[model samples]
Target: MTPPLALDIDGTLTTPSGRIDPRVFELLPDWDAPVVFATGKAFPYPVALAHFLGRPEFVIAENGGVAYVDGETAVLGDPTAPRAVVEAFRERGGEVGWGDGDTVNRWRETEVALSLDADEALLREVAAAADGDVTVVDTGYAYHVKSPAASKGKALERVADALGIATEAFVAIGDSENDASTFAVAGESYAVANADATAREAADVVLDEAYMDGTETVLAALRERGE
Candidate 1:
């Protein structure tokens, strides 16, 4: 059997503005392999995408705080991060937009998606305010305030176990800092040409194209290898 494909949705499979390029759909290989989405997008987004794909295999959402598969959803990480953390950041004059009741953040169980500029110092202060129990992950699009245990790699392990597939029987692809964990754990990891330096360093293969074009490139390579 072909190994499952674990994909990061945002910069890995969509345009910079997060739209799926129609050309990407055209390039999708005709295969029965499981296509698991490992992303920081909220639960509903990935679930809807899976439904559109006609294959709702598995989804790792909110940077591994949640997992959905086979009509069942599970919280994979601790949901105890204090809500005051966001307030504290705001008090410190950090611009933060919470995704609590929004379309994407509503489905998040533990993590709080904060739409803000990437300020490492401010993020560190926010993490400290949470008593070090929460960590800030820069997902390229936003900073997620989540438990230290939340990670895409851990989610992949859980999904792989459920599918009865070895960890080595998977291909992981992404384009940002949060994706570094997925790249580290995948059997074969790939990054699009536009991926950040950290992701590029972690990947075994880096495609020349960007976004969905890069995704198509990797999928084609995987198909060739399987052939």
Candidate 2:
């Protein structure tokens, strides 16, 4: 059987400037196997992408804080620790820098996503101080303050469980550190050419193409292998 696929958005499916690559509209909707969007982005982002692309809405969002599979929803992460961490950061004069509107985090449910420009050291210290349950992850695009328990690997496990699939049967593709956990759970994992050190190190294969081009390359390979 063709493997179920887990895909990361942002740096994986987007151009360097953060626009969705047009080819996704053509290929993803018709992919033979299941497609799961695994992203550190808020719940809506991946779900919305699946809607627009006409792919399966099976999604692992907020870095595993939330998931949607087979028309059911699961929320697994705690928002308290992340909120406390952010509050402490603000007290320490650290700014999240998404500006007043802060749409990036306004809708987030389980974690705090800060700009890459945020002070990592400060965020870590705050996370450690408030609750050891929360950990800090640098996704290359942003810093995530969340529970380690709520991660892509864990969410994938739940998805697999829900669908009677094996946790080790997925093929994952991504381009940053946020993808590392998913890589660990997958049967085969690919890091796009522009992947950060963590993702490249975790993946079984590092593709030559970058960004959406790399995603297309992997999809093409899957098609050929499926044939």
Candidate 3:
């Protein structure tokens, strides 16, 4: 069997607008291997996507703060990190806005999603205030304040162990800085054309196409290799 494929959701499988093109869904059925989703997204989003794919294999959420597999969910990091980071930010007079109403954000366990107006200084200040207790990761959509222990690479390792597969037997594809961990631990790492510079640098393969097209390209290559 071909090694599993671990994918990042936003900006990899979806458009910039965060919508999964129907064409991408059309390509899913052809890939005959475990498809694990590793994303900065919270809980239900990953679970829902797995259901849609008809592959409830494994999901790494909140950049690996949470993992779901085989009808079981596990929290891999300190769940209190988000609250501590938020409080520290507030104490420093930083005005933070939560993605409270958003369905996915509302379900987050180990991280808090906050939107900023490209205020890099404020982000740095918040990180400093945490004193290395937590980490602030920018997912392009929002800043995820989470524990330093959380990592997509670690989560992927857990999934690999659960599936009785070697850690180096998976193809990881992603498009952002948070995906750096996924790329680091993957046997083969791929980045779409639209991937951020950091992600592209970490990947072994950078596709010419973006979004769903890039994903399909990787899947096609995998199929060809297997044949």
Question: How many clashes show up in model 2?
Answer: 0
Instruction: Please list the residue runs of candidate 2 whose C-alpha ends up more than 4 Å from where it truly belongs after superposition.
Output: none
Q: Considering only N, C-alpha and C atoms within 3 Å, which residue pairs clash in candidate 3?
A: none
Global fold similarity of model 2 (TM-score): 0.95
Ranking by lDDT: 2, 3, 1
> Which tens-of-lDDT digit does each residue in 27-125 have in candidate 1?
543455888888887888878777777676589998888887766677887866734676677787876664345565666677777775545588677
Clashing pairs in 2: none
- Across 8-43, the per-residue lDDT of candidate 3 in tens digits comes to 999998986889867657866556777888999887
What TM-score number comes out for model 3?
Answer: 0.92
| Number of backbone collisions per candidate | 0, 0, 0
lDDT comparing candidate 3 with the true structure = 0.82
Give TM per candidate: 0.90, 0.95, 0.92
Candidate with best TM-score? 2
Task: Give the per-residue Cα lDDT of candidate 1 at 29.
Answer: 38
Model 2, global lDDT: 0.89
